[model samples]
Target chain A: MEELLAEVVNVLVVIVEACGAAVIIIGAVWAFARFAWVGFRQRTTAAFVPVRLTLGRFLALGLEFQLASDVLRTAVAPSWEELGQLAAVAAIRTALNYFLSKEIAEERRQVAAEQDHHEVTSTDHRGSGV
Target chain B: MSAVAEVTRLAALGTGLAAVVAGALALVVTRRPLPALAVLLDLLLAAGLLRLAGDPDWQGIVTAAAIVALRHLIGVGLRAGGRAWTGPRPPAASAQEKSAL
Candidate 1:
């Protein structure tokens, strides 16, 4: 029975890891496709705002999946080596996620500021009737 | 082979395949040089997972770290490029002379 339980747990771990990889793949593909379409349609410099925002979000999601998979890999009886590796992987992934999120927030603020500037300029132009 | 080990191998293979596909898609999507960095990260993560599955792939982790560093370097270069591209260009000497006249 214990052997059977181990097998079950191993299977679960594999499934979780597979799911995490799938999530990262899907997120990256989706963000890339969206960015491509936007870039093709609008060749303006402003097009980068949406591209950056979308890519940033996808990257954060992918990093989360990678982190989850790392955690799951150690769910079973982890050796000291495995534990050490997990610690390193987890730290790297967490740091990447943190910085990506911070950049995303900064990009969001820039986008908002640009929109506000555009609105004010339009309002001023309209008020002057030119 | 033990069932656990077999499952881990399969999982690693699946992850590698997914990462390759994701990387290809990212590369295809953008003309800018930015997406390549993300693609490299995806590939690195996939390689790292495979290494974790008892594969003798110590170099994968090192390569991933190098790729991350390269991504940072590229990001800095891109930022500089963007600033140069957008910054005001000085008026041509002819235009300046005409204005002066």
Candidate 2:
């Protein structure tokens, strides 16, 4: 029974790890395609907002899955080496997530500010009959 | 090795699969990534719970939970920033109305 359970656990871990990797790969590819399409359409920094936002979101999610898988892989029987590796991976991913989120927030603010400015200018022009 | 460990691994796999599918849908079909992002964060919390099922390691589970919470906090802050940016616009008035006033 113990052996059977270990086999089951090992299979489950493999499946989860595989799925996590697949998700990351697919998400990265899809995000890249979308970003390229956007870039092709408009070459301006402003035009890249959607691409950055979308890609950042996808990457962030993929990183989280990757992190979760790492945690699971080490949860059952963590050696010192495995624990050390997990710590390093977690730190790197956490840092990436933080910066990506910061950039996304900044872009969102810029977009909102631009839209508001546009609206105000349009309103002024209409009021002036110009 | 143990039943608990097996269960934890199974839960992680299940949640991992769900996160992947939700992420794909957000990227392709719906084009709405925020909710999917939230779902992914939620999955982190679930993964943390599953971790507890195996070996009572506070470090891993706590880290996962902290990440999820931090994400939510950041999201709230960003939304607040957006609102602040858009909050100060004056209402529009017609030329005739402005001249009369």
| DockQ leader | 1
> Pairs clashing in candidate 1?
none
TM per prediction = 0.64, 0.50
* CAPRI level of candidate 2: incorrect
Give residue B14's lDDT in candidate 1 (0 to 100).
Answer: 59
lDDT of 1 by residue, A1-130 (tens): 8677668766766665555545554554555455456545654445646755765676577567667666666666547865766676567667667767876787698689889989999999999996
TM-score of chain B of each: 0.44, 0.57
Least well predicted 10-residue stretch by lDDT in candidate 1 chain A: A20-29
Backbone clashes in model 1? 0
In candidate 2, position A16 carries an lDDT of 59
Compose the digit string of candidate 2's lDDT tens values, residues B37-96: 544554443344344333334465566557656865766675576577647655464556
